[model samples]
Target: MARQVSLATQLAQSPSAWNGHIAPLILRAMTDVYITLAWIFQDREKRTDEYVKYGLGQRKLWLEHFKRSLVERGEKEPEKNLFVKALTRQLNAERFEHITEVNVGAWSERSTRKMAEEAGCLDLYRLAYTPFSTAVHSMWTHIAGYNLRRCRNPLHQFHRVPEDSDLEPDIDYVYRAAKYVAKTFALFDRETGVSVETPSSLDQFVESLAHPTGEAQTDSPDPLDDL
Candidate 1:
């Protein structure tokens, strides 16, 4: 049987559809990190004995898979290695300093805004604000999910608690940290003017930045040989 075609499908099939699909997905993926962390923290508060064990197990598996994928590409390409290194450094710094330092607090906001202005990304800043806020909401949802799963209190009962309330500073911190990383990457992409379509791979991302359009591709050894 032939499937019925819809106008939406036809529009999606068009080459110039201007579909903004990737933006949402990127935001979601980054936000998921905060959501997962919120669950871990909420479970801890509830004294759910299995929460830590299960959550840590899940986190280990997820991090292993993510690191393996990043490392594989880094091994084959110099430019990719540099990007992976830089990303690792940034993530580590954020993790150490905590997300509150990067997200919602007055100092954090001032610093972030300054960086965005310096990078000439005020437009990206405006566009990403809602996505960043959405990510924070996703984190709250995760916390709510944990509370519901534990049967401690119904989600509706807790609905009155504002997201930025002083009740859950840790969760807010996690959300802020995640947003900081996203904002940084978005700024990098904007400044480099890298095309996100073809370069889905880490190697391609690094290569595109290292070798922008109209630049000569070198035949020499990998630039990251020393690393």
Candidate 2:
């Protein structure tokens, strides 16, 4: 959680990273990470083991792809063999290539939706995660509505085409990202009864929005700002 939030904070520093085109991807990933972390804490030993194995399996799967690429195109691209061998050696530090089992399915053998349901965060999955998935997957529902605009030419049939969207920067994504980090902190405290001296990044972000003179801003803040 600390690492995730630290990376998020660094990304948040870049205003361009907050755009609708990119922010949803990070927010969606954060939601998955949070929900998965919460679920893992419920059964740390077993789930963590499963998670580690799944990651290794994925690495092996990637190594196999590289190996196949080398075999198929070794003559044309000889450097790939050296890179693949180097990667295989690095991966073998933990478990041998022969011993590491490959699992092509979900690590937990349960879908993230099911895990989110068990973790009592199905609402987050439904509202934020699933909607953001449309953008990540480039679903017709999102691209057609967001990226494509109808042509104004009356002579030709109204046809939709992609446009370079010029959308105003929305602070809402920052708030959502901060909220996820805060939730992670809260989850950590809840699970381990550990308390830190400093305030969460979310609180700091909201507090930073105040006028420098220590007076509150006059405008009505978004309700989520209270988070």
Highest-scoring model, TM-score: 2
Best by lDDT: 2
* Cα lDDT, model 1, residue 201: 31
Cα RMSD of all models vs. native, in order, equals 22.2, 6.2
Residue 116 displacement (Å), model 1:
21
Off by over 4 Å in 1: 1-22, 34-204, 212-215, 219-227
Please give, for residues 4-83, the per-residue lDDT of candidate 1 as tens digits.
Answer: 11222233244342223223334444333323332333334542344333433444444446667866766544324665
**What TM-score does candidate 2 get on C-alpha atoms?**
0.86
Residue lDDT tens for model 2, 61-104: 98877767766864565435678768777878876567878999
Clashes of each: 0, 0
Lowest lDDT 10-mer window, candidate 2?
Answer: 73-82
What 10-residue stretch in candidate 1 is worst by lDDT? 1-10
